[model samples]
Target: MKKEIIIKHLGVVLLLNGVFLFISFLISFFLNESSTVALLFSALICGIFGVFPLIFVERTEHISFNEGLTIVVLGWIITCVVGMLPYLMWGGEFTLTNAWFESVSGFTTTGSTILTEIESLPKGILFWRSSTHWIGGIGVILFVLLILPRSKGQRITIYNTEISSLSKMNFRYNTRKIVHILAVVYISLTLLETIALMVFGMNFFDAINHSFATIATGGFSTKNLSIAEYNNLGIEVIIMVFMILSGNHFGLIYGTIMLKKENLFRSSLARTFVSVLLIGVLLVTLKLYLSGTYDLLTSLRYASFQVISLGTTTGFATVDTIHWPIFTQIILIYFTIQCAMSGSTSGGLKFDRVYIFFKLLGKQIKLLKHPNSVFVSKFDGKRIDEKLEEQTLVFIVLYVAVFFATTIILTAMDIDGMTAFSASIATLGNVGPGFENVSSLGNFASLPDFGKFVLSVNMLLGRLEIFNILALIMIKK
Candidate 1:
């Protein structure tokens, strides 16, 4: 299976992580923080391991599908392992399980955390944490693809493995161009958000970190109260704008910026996604206001933020939604399951699939009424073939089964039904905060170690998109 080629590519992933770790180390070193040595040591470990393989293995221009898949899967597992090193060594709230959970959550951009006192951590550690989101937001393998000076075949192989077919639906470019589009859109959004935050009186460090979290849709906050700590309407408005943008397809964003044909306004999927989010906001805001939860403006503020936050799978909280009305919570839960667009940073059961699911359902209903009629399902004006349609349906079923299985496993751990169910979907959707014990503004510190571990696996499954891991397993068998 071209094991050497796999190792070489995986080494690149580690090296990329090592670079971020070193940046974190420098932050700790300059600040004389407690995590300095830990960050430094972790960075060194990544560098040494990363370099050794590159030194020994000759670079190959071509990689098999199995090798590419192995590299992509193992690359994430390895990165997560190394990611926990700083937390494990720093040792404040980080036990072994806690470190692993935090690492998985970070790289998966799940935003779920084990820290009870997030503000107590060193700046370097916090930066490293946010860095994980940025690195993983676009994907570690995609970063490697950008740097790898390989042939088109090599790039395409890894690209196919790293990105899903659904994500590539709107991207009309070749492999290199597609990767470049993602990088450009990703970096531009991050920089723009950072500047906006700083202009609104956020300090540079916090601004950049929050930008990393926002553009990545990763939801990790520098403060304990998340965006609520700022309490600035301007800041909230800026983040909400970016959060919505980040949730849309990056290619569409690029196209819109470049005045291309496949822009967000031209894409039906993008329009529907936005419409659904607005509808969610309206429903939640109306309920909050009518229930006397808050005045109209106040209700609109919190409801819009939470709705968009969870809708995009960003998970940042402007309010503690646990105290909200049940109808509002259910609406939020629906958004958690129906996450953002496919090509964006946010993960989980993407809104595109949900859109397609409904379309397919309508097609089936029409067929029942007219037995001889042929019904064709299409998305964004493109025909959906039977094969892709079957695959999407299978994916949805698998997604449901996996989350339900996780819920069962968590319940077996003796967690409350609400916590277990919400946590299951939350982690599986990579949507961070859930209701009950793991609600918005609450940490995962109270969960059993095994439960945290299970959720960590859920985050990985969500990030890997179910099929990749299953394909890898089949390859092994």
Candidate 2:
């Protein structure tokens, strides 16, 4: 590994974080909130650390996969750690564990919060909270890749760490162009979402925060009740639309925007993702109505929003799924696991793999019947290689195994089975909420420190996807 490159990239992270902290300080200064000292101090510390690395580490022209992997993984870990400084120092509902949980949740774009009162936070700190989503949504590595005047090869090395294989399908551009496209799509969506929310009766602060959340699929609403606080169908609809869009591959969004032939509209995986989500919504709506939970209109209202929210791994809630019928909860859980498309802000086992997984399964079945048949599983006429199939299958198994292990560990700590299972799946899926004790509108603050730490690791693993992590670990081995 190139230690200098790792330090240099880490330095860039510190600088980026410092910029946000300075913004927070300015907010506190203007508003005269108690956060001024803490935020400013944090900014100074980050800036000093950032500059120290710059002074010591010389510039490099390229980075190997090992350095890039280390930077991405360590960058996330450090980002969460540094992100907690303000929350840690400000000290309200933010206990050390709670602060870490909240920071990790934000940076992971998971949207889970320890605060019962979202409106209770200062504007500056709240903006910082939402900023974490924006920064983390595109990925810390991608952000560095975007800004650093780096070569395509150098960017590709880091891009490998930031985005999973499935997410890259539509990104035919070289690394530099891809970065430009990602930035444009990300910024445009955020700006548009903010404007839309503002038009629908949200204040500028809340609008910006929610937009940041939406475009990032990071769902940290300023109101504790989330989008329900507005009670505006128009607002919810706009948000749902963007949530789905943001959950999709940015490459597709760029392609569509640039009027390229290949885009979200062209991808089979995108179609399947939407179709599955639609079916999930329809099923949940029926269950809710039949169970007498809500009338048809009300059921569709909440069901559609909640399904899309979780399906995209956005996690904004109009209604808590925990109190819904068991059947409804199951449908919601499926969406959570399925997640959004690859190459977008949303995390977890992306829809691309899930779609391919079934196709691969069908090919296996046919191969079984035909004996000596040569079968090729294809996605949108693109032949899926045997190695790709094996990789996807391994990811699926590891994804389930990790969740199961987390559940077992949580249950051993005297938690209920349902809560443990849901919590495990929620964090592993990078979906914010779970059922029962960790339900929508609930927080992970109550978890034991060790449990919280374990869950945080799961969040990183899920966001980064399993193989990149394994690859990084195996590099040393």
Candidate 3:
């Protein structure tokens, strides 16, 4: 297992995180926020640890899949450790546990928060929150892999760890090209959203921060009420459009931008993803209207917004859903579990997996009907390997099991069944927000410290993907 090589690669990740911290510090200083010292100190600490390895270790030409797995899993843990330092040092709603929880939430792009009053946070700290989304949106290692100028042969394996299987379908390009395409699309969308927000009268800083959150499908908002605080239909529509786009595979967005044949419009998986979301919106809207949760138009508006928000793994809230009917909440929770596409920023049991699961179901039914018949599962007519199908199924079971276990633990701690269950699935899916105590507008501040800690671990496990962490533990001696 080339431990030194893994350390060296990890050092690169630390350095990347340090750069972002430095940026946050400057923003803090300019804004005269109390978070400056925290950001500066965190940056220094990251720099010291990151650079020390460079002095002791030599560069390697390659890493094994095992080593890559170790670097990625450990890299995330280390990144979260480092990512929390500023909040810890700043000392507001951020005690050690709170900092770790928030940092994990940020880097995981879960957008689940523990703070009760987000607007009370300093601008620099808020920017740091949005920055975590930007960094984690693509992935910490991905940022390193994308910006760094070299190959270690295990690039695709690392990328697969960082992204998801479903996201890679549209990319026939080589590793470098794929990274380039992802970067271009990510940056372009962020810039475009920022411009749109600015035109809607957000200041440059708030617009940039909000754009970062939106493009990442991260629900961290400059305002406590999130995009709702804007009160502009234009802003909401712009956010919604981008949210839907960000929820799809970045590779497809790249294809469309590059004028490649396999664009978003052509991908059957993407079509189904949106179609399912629309249906969910329609259902939730009808339920809300029938129940008098809102007028017809208002119900549709909030329903579509909330549906897409959770559907994409973004956690922004215009209205608290804790009081919404159980049926509406169930629909939103379904989207939360079924997150956005693999190639994009959203995470969870990706729509691709759900699609694959149904296809695999049909394959099984066919096999039962014709015992000797060959049944090859397909996604968009591409043959889905038996191994991949098996792995996906295992992942889903593990995901549910973990969620259930976490829920049980929380329930034992006296958290309600609904809150515990929703929180468990929310963290397990890397989708932010839960019901009751941790609902759309509610925060996790009141959770027992140990419960918050457990959920943070769940967030990391989800963000890393279950198998990657498992593979990290099972590396051959």
79-184 in candidate 2: lDDT tens per residue? Answer: 9999999999998989888888888889988887778877888888998999989889966436646544444435443355346555566777666777788888
RMSD after CA superposition, every candidate: 2.0, 2.1, 2.2
Candidate 2 Cα deviation (angstroms), residue 136: 0.4
Model with the higher TM-score, candidate 1 or 2: 1
Residue pairs clashing in model 1 are none
Segments in model 1 whose C-alpha atoms lie over 4 Å from true places: 144-169
Q: What is the lDDT of residue 444 in candidate 3?
A: 88
Lowest summed lDDT across 10 adjacent residues in model 2 is found at 149-158
Which candidate, 1 or 3, would have the higher lDDT against the true structure? 1
For residues 225-330, could you state the per-residue lDDT of candidate 1 as single tens digits?
9999999999999999999999998888998999988889988888999999999999999999999999999999999999999999889998898889999999
Model 2 pairs in collision? 167-343
Error of 3 at 17 (Å): 1.5
lDDT of 2: 0.83
Span of ten consecutive residues with least summed lDDT in model 1: 155-164
Give the lowest summed-lDDT range of ten residues in model 3: 147-156
Clashes (N, CA, C under 3 Å) per candidate? 0, 1, 0
